[model samples]
Target: MADPQEPRMTAKRFHARPGVEDWRVLFWGAHAFYAADSLTHAVALASAVAEIADGLDHHPDLDVRPHGVTIRTRTRRGGGLGPLDAELARRVQEFARGEGYRPDPSTLMVTGIAVAQDRDADVRPFWAAIMGYEPLDDADAVDPQRRNPHVWVHELTPPKPGRGRTHIDLSVPADHAKARVEAALAAGGRLVSASPEGWTIASPDNHGVDIAIWPDFEDFGEDG
Candidate 1:
């Protein structure tokens, strides 16, 4: 229980003002996230959000919860869902993605996934010897038709440390982290965590991916 002097946290709701359904304003409703299970959790969360917002120039309507905070950031001038709102959503999403949160599919779609092959040198050497594909300028080789056909490889900075293998990272809308986890589980993916950072899911083959749910692209400051 919170101390008597502690600030009380309550549930709150935010809705668009009537007749403000324009795409710029109404594209998204209020956003929500669960805070950590402690009083200091709210303070830390608010501080982090304030820093990020200060950097972005965009502001959000926030509700403080004992465990987490819910933020609704949409451009009233835009009316419903505008560039600013989307950019904020993406920025938040990227932050959450880095933290391993998974989004719900009902709430979002997997925009992209990157497979980082840390052992490019070793892997490339073996593949180049076994296959006849010509080596590329970057030292990473690929068969245009046989490979992902969509994925592009790039150099790793400083090289990967001991024994790191490939890893999969998934992206989704920021608000759908929970829903995405449920969907992936329903589709034969296994749930790994229910922590505040987000959820994790893995396929039957032991192939695991992080479903990072973030806001749409327009929310970031540069998107302007």
Candidate 2:
């Protein structure tokens, strides 16, 4: 049996579990989306998920759209997944099935910006000023409302211009990354690189985007 005192569940362990097909780890949390046929259906589904979170005393971030309800769970205290989160996910899946909500896994994604700048330079302040994002650390910042992509400041010596170092990072599930890469390829995008984590692709005009396995880095310490 797993120890109750275990504070965090790594991404590997979380993904190895069964019956969690509806959930995918993204950024700092595990996310699941359920599609509803109508706005009324979405609200009711959200309410059901709310009850599951409340019962577990481990609430997840909930977004109720016109067509679906997105729920994200994590261990805010330990900065990663907790057992309660898995429990919440299981319950949500159970309720979703009973309620006829369709689990939509392909839509799960986390997007961010990767800025490669001079090692001695600090660009976070400038990005924070313009994007209205709050600095999360010496090299990163995020939107206060969580409405925008996160900004990660990666230091590069000499900071060569147009080396494809600065680009958008689209993090998705391992299974989903392949499809994203394939779709990009079919759309005339050129592959810049590839790895087990994901791939970097360039648009026709040379704009680059990195599609990667999400929660690439952990311990975001995000409570909101």
Name the Cα RMSD for model 2: 4.3
Residue range 1-224, candidate 1, lDDT tens digits: 11334222111111132311211211233353534556576656666666677787877755665655555565432113344454555565555445543332233232222334464444555555555544444434444332221122444555674443443555444444566677788889887765544556778777767665433222323211
- Those runs of model 1 whose alpha carbons end farther than 4 Å from true positions after fitting are 1-108, 119-168, 194-197, 215-224
lDDT of 2 by residue, 138-198 (tens): 6678887766788888877666654436789887877677888889999999999887667
TM-score of 1: 0.32
lDDT of each: 0.45, 0.77
TM-score of 2: 0.86
- Global CA lDDT computed for model 2: 0.77
